[model samples]
Target: MNAPRSLDARLTEQRNPRTARIDQLATLEIVDLINAEDRMVAAAVGEERQQIARAIDIVVECLRAGGRLFYVGAGTSGRLGVLDASEMPPTYRTDPALVQGIIAGGLDALVRAQEGAEDHAGDGAAAMDEKNVDARDFVLGIAASGTTPYVHGALQRARERGARTGFLLCSWPSEALMKTHDVVIAPLVGPEVITGSTRMKAGTATKIVLNTISTAAMVKLGKVYGNLMVDLQVTCQKLQDRGERILMATVGVSREEAQRLLDESGGHVKTAIVMASRSLDAQEARQRLDAAGGSVTELVGTLPVA
Candidate 1:
C-alpha cells in the first residue's frame, strides 16, 4: 500500500515550535513572540531575491511590449495582489488596465472571507479566459500555502493562453512546480505564530516582495528620478505639495517658480521638472519627454547627488 500523505506537509500549515506557548503568555509576551517571528520574514524574502528579480524583469518586459500584468489569488493573498495593483495608477501614473487583480470570488471576496471560493478550480480557469490573457501578458499567482486550487487553476490556464506565468508562495515548491512556472519565488517564512494564520509573517513577506518587484520595475521604466517619484500626477493637495517640492529640489527653483512650473505643466511633476531644467515651455517639454521615452534623466541628465 502507498504511504499516507501527511496533512501537515505544507510548511505554512505546520506548527511553529517557538510559538507553541504563545497563547498562554501575557499580551506583551505574545507581542514579543510574534515580533520575533516577523524578523525572519525579511531574510526569507531575501533568500528568493534572484527569483524576485527575474519576475520583475518579466513584468517590465511585458509592460514595455504594451501588455498588461495580472495578479491572481484568493483570500489574503488575493487582497494583497489587488492592493498592490490598485496603487500603480496613482503612484506611477499607469493606466488602470495596465495592472489588474483577480480574486477567486471576485471583488466581493475582498472584504469578506470567501473560504469556499478557493476550492473551485474552474472559476480560476474562467477568470484567465475572461481577462483575455495573451502571450505578451504576464500573470503572477500569489498563494502562501503553495497549494491554493484557485491560484493553480488560474496559472494553468494563463500558461495555456501563452502568457508568461510566475508563482509566489511561502512554502517549498515541488519539482513539478519549479519546472512549470517561468519563475517561482518561495519565501519560506516558516509556520505562522498561530499555526496556519499566514496573515502574519507570510503576508508581511508577500507585501515586501510585491513592493520590491513593483518599485524596481517602476524605477527601471524611468518612473523615478534620483529616488523620487517624478512620474507622479498631482491629484490632491498632498500630491500638489509634493509635486511642487520635487520641482523646487530637482530644478533648483524657488517656491514661486516651482508653483508656476507645476501649473504650466498641468500638475505633472516630471513635465514640470523637464520644463524648468531645459528652459522649455510646457508643450516643448512634453515633446522632449515623449522623444526621450518619458525618461527625465535622458533629457535633463541625472539628478545631482545631494
Candidate 2:
C-alpha cells in the first residue's frame, strides 16, 4: 500500500520559525509574536486582489442572471461560509435563496466538529443535487489546506451541472485546482500561530474575502447607494433608526419627515429616498425604481441639497 502524503509541504501545516521558542516566551512576548504574524495576513490577501476581484465579478454576473451563490466547506470554513451567507438579508435586504452556504455534515455539524464528514466526496456531490444547482449558479469551495475532499467533490458536481465554480484556500493551490475552478482565491496566510489550528489567520482572511465578494456583489445589484446600505430591511428599532437617518442624509429631509417617508415606503430605505427626492408617492417611487433597476440615485437623478 502507498504511504499517505505528508502535509508538511503545505504552507498552512508548516511550523513558524519565528515562534519556535513561543513556549519559552513571556506573556507579553507571546502576544507580540502573534500580533506580528497577524499583521502579515492583510498583505497576503492584498497579493490576491486580482483573483478576489475576479471572483466578485463572477458572483455579480451569476446573481444578475437570477442565479444564486453557494459557499461549500467544512469545520471553521463551513462556519464562516454560513456566517457570511446568513447576514445578507438583514444587511442588504437580499432574498434568502440568493446566497447560500453548504457545509459538510449538514446543519448538525455546524455546532460540532464533523471532521470525518469532509472525507466523503460522494456526499458533497449529493449536496449539489439537493440544491438543484444549475448553469446560472456559482459554487465556491473553501478549504484552508486546499485539499478538502468534500469541497472538491461539490465543485466537481457543480461543474457537471454547468455551474461556474470557484475555490478559496489558504495554502498554495496545485495546478489541477487552479485549472478546475473558474476563479481561484488563494491567500497564503502561512501557518497558524497554534500550528495546524487554521481558525485564526486563515479564518480572518476568509471572512475578509467573503465580505468583499458579498458586499461588492450587492453593490452591483443596487443594494447599496453611495456608501450606505440603501436596501436595508428595517426589521427592528436600530434598522428603523438607520433607515430614517439614511433618508435624512440623502434626501435632505428632517428627522420627522424621514420617519414619515420610512413609514410611507414600508421601511425600505431606497424607496423612501426615491419618494422623497423625486416628490413621488410610494407606488410611483417603486415604479421608478423598477424602471431604473432598483437604483435610488439612478431614478432620482440627483440628491436634494441639504
lDDT of 1 by residue, 1-306 (tens): 543333888999888778766778999999888889999999999999999999999999999998999999999999999999999999999999999999989999999999999999889999999999999999999999989999999999999999999999999999999999999999999989988899999999999999998899899888999999999999999999999889888988998888899888998999998888888999999999888888999999988888
Off by over 4 Å in 1: 1-6
Clashes of 1: 0
Q: Give the per-residue lDDT of model 2 (tens digit) for 1-306.
A: 543333688888887777778999999999999999999889989999999999999999999899999999999998999999999999998899999999999999889998999999999999999999999999999999889999989999999999999999999899988888899999999878878889989999999999989998888888888888999978999999999888878877899999999988988999998888778999998898988888776776654544
Name the lDDT value of residue 186 in candidate 1.
95
Task: Please report, in order, the local distance difference test score of every candidate based on alpha carbons.
Answer: 0.92, 0.91
Please give the range of 10 consecutive residues that has the lowest summed lDDT in model 2. 1-10
Question: Residue 28 of candidate 1: its Cα lDDT?
Answer: 96
Q: Distance (Å) between predicted and true CA of 267, model 2?
A: 0.7
